[model samples]
Target: MTADLGARRASICPEPPFNALFNIRMPFIYPTSQLSLERKTPVVSTANVGQLAVDLIIASLSLQRVAILESGYCVPVVGAREDGQKGITTALELYGHPGVDFVVIQQRSPVLKVGAYSLVCLDARSALRLQSRKEEFIKALLNFIKDSKFGAVLFLSGVDLSNRTDSQMTTPTYQIRPENSPTLAGTALQRLSSLPIPKYTSPVSQEAQPAESSSSTPFIPGGGITRRILSSLPSEWSVPTASILQFVLEGDNRADAGLLASVVVKILGKEVPQWRQPGSWRDGLFGTPHDQTLFG
Candidate 1:
């Protein structure tokens, strides 16, 4: 019965186009509402910390779903609705409050990592495809930001805690801005600079840094695509962009998400509202509770 159901579903769902990554098809953004996004700041989420922080922001600010982002770069996923919404949710979606100065792009699934899987399967072709997909995705996203006329863009990510230096141990959060970005004063990036958070310095030793020492391109270990996206921006680009990141180890990171979300709120100069955990977090986030009867 299960095999039959799986076959039926597979037949119903169309297969992704061949050479889709190589062809570089542009992602489609479908707006569900009449919300004007012009001049609004956008927060792009990456890594676990970023995703969870975005979730907290949506719940706290009561941000509504404004658009759905259809992209081939991400692994296709559909599951129960987030934030207690009625219908199912897809891999990527946009959320925002009407009058709020900032919006968020929540990525519910990780980027397609065919290369990692290819190692196990020993298929070199899959590795090449992964690289192409990632590059195309970055190009598509940057083009969208440039055309959207947004006031600024913020990226959130998590750095590997193991890479932290002794000095960095005092502060778990850090900020990175492209040196070439002509960010003016009073912008969200500048506002974040005013905070006590330390600027991210590459952990690589000076001897090893000579090869990748461009100040404009930062090294962010464990921050998936954060550095790539920032470095890919053209030097002549006018949009202001920055990344806020936290050093975290994989585990129950709910507390880390809260702290990072607070920093984001501060950067926007908005009063931090009472954070309400989404229904998904409260219910089965970690998994079903262990039965005490086992111990007995």
Candidate 2:
């Protein structure tokens, strides 16, 4: 059978726009790649694809125009703890270089949410019957990263089988709450890992009870300027874990966003120079991070 390019069309992924999510300004770095490092194809776990997406966006952008229709769903990892869910995002934004496009966030309500990525949402506050101030602050920071014209994101709500379809894409995805992903909530990225959507039945947890929250504690702290400008986030959005990457690629839809991201990485790795690792650099001259090849 012959391949059909014209007959095939890309899915119209409608995620959030950039700049809408960020409440503060942060620095970002966008490096241009000279060598492609794909001596072998890159395989990722859908369960942890959140991290893969970050790597892909950073690497691909350095080489060429990069776009991801991230439809990886997720479960919860961390939330607004009583320790005062304030300023954590502030600590993170200081790290990124100022050159991104969007931090798209798409979801299908309680169906599925990204458990790995760090973010703020109304759920965090409401989980304790409090206003979602902290979640809003995180959202603001996310918008800043996306609006920089650097990159974009497509956050999808809901899960597979349960929702019946992969992406209903109700709300738009934005970078208001995007952060250094694959937070402690997610597992580390490895060549060998599980994919998203378990092939077998996962052990069901017993009935759970949530911790109590204090209402007096504003969803955020007493930062007058920060609090004044940012609005509370709605309970609709969520950040997912990075592990979903591998699963989406190998899931029911072989050609969904997860597979597309993998294919994109493979394609870019083929032509780009950075994908190929350069020889070890001068030992002390630069003290730069070396590329740790996974498998040959």
Candidate 3:
């Protein structure tokens, strides 16, 4: 399953989203009625074809087009919602670093009040099902990417990957880290703190940092191989929660998975310790912790 280490993704490289100096509009998302609410729900509705919903998810990945992240990165989060705001925040904090170029989009105010950039709002799930236009879905997605300035995108959501047909465009794992190169693997490990990791815990994944650190999770190295994780625990740690993140695909066991989240939440980092398999994680440094929440 592993390939090489020297490969580079023209999409995600050492540069930021707006690499060029000037106020160049990297891309644009054409609005569509298809993005609006359906006819079925007229009376008790405050949503659409998941328009703002999708936008919020996209923003969560892009950093609102600033220095923390690039413009092209994206992800779908069927699991995300105004309630999942903290997790979304954790993901953004985890991924974006002075080192990371990813962003986090969250609905800060009520729909009737404050507004946010790089983000769109939508109604709840039931109202949303009224419009499942896959074509419109992929079109808006494609158009958004073509118009944006960034290179790659990660379309996420609770949506199933195997069931969908047109959602073919995406960044492959090999791009994150060439399947073969140990050195490159080493670099990614160090840069892990660069992206968002979401704060909630699991028996398995997502980035883990303390509840406070989740406010701005950063990827870092150290920790250890899946089997050796117990050895890497900070000497004075009072709390620890283990989980398996959805994005990590090396098919790692709970050990690596746990540490991965610990890093996102606790800022625990070091070299990419040995792992049960490749793609488990990339390595980097564990920076200081930030203020955040704690969950059981």
Best by TM-score: 1
Q: What order do you get sorting by lDDT, best first?
A: 1, 2, 3
Predictions in order: lDDT: 0.79, 0.26, 0.25
Candidate 2 C-alpha lDDT tens digits along 16-133: 2243234333333222332222121122222223333433333444422122212222232322211243421111111112232222221111213222222333422311122243
- Stretches of candidate 3 off by over 4 Å are 1-100, 104-132, 158-296
TM-score of 1: 0.82
Q: Which segments of candidate 2 are over 4 A away from where they belong? A: 1-47, 56-129, 142-260, 263-296
List per-candidate RMSD values in Å: 7.9, 23.1, 24.2
- Per-residue lDDT over 87-114 for candidate 1, one digit per residue giving the tens place of the 0 to 100 score: 7788889888788988999998777754
TM-scores of the models, in the order given: 0.82, 0.24, 0.21
How many steric clashes between backbone atoms does each model show? 0, 88, 69
Model 2: ten consecutive residues of lowest lDDT: 88-97
Task: Write down the TM-score for model 2.
Answer: 0.24
In model 2, the Cα lDDT at residue 192 comes to 16
**Model 1: C-alpha RMSD to truth?**
7.9
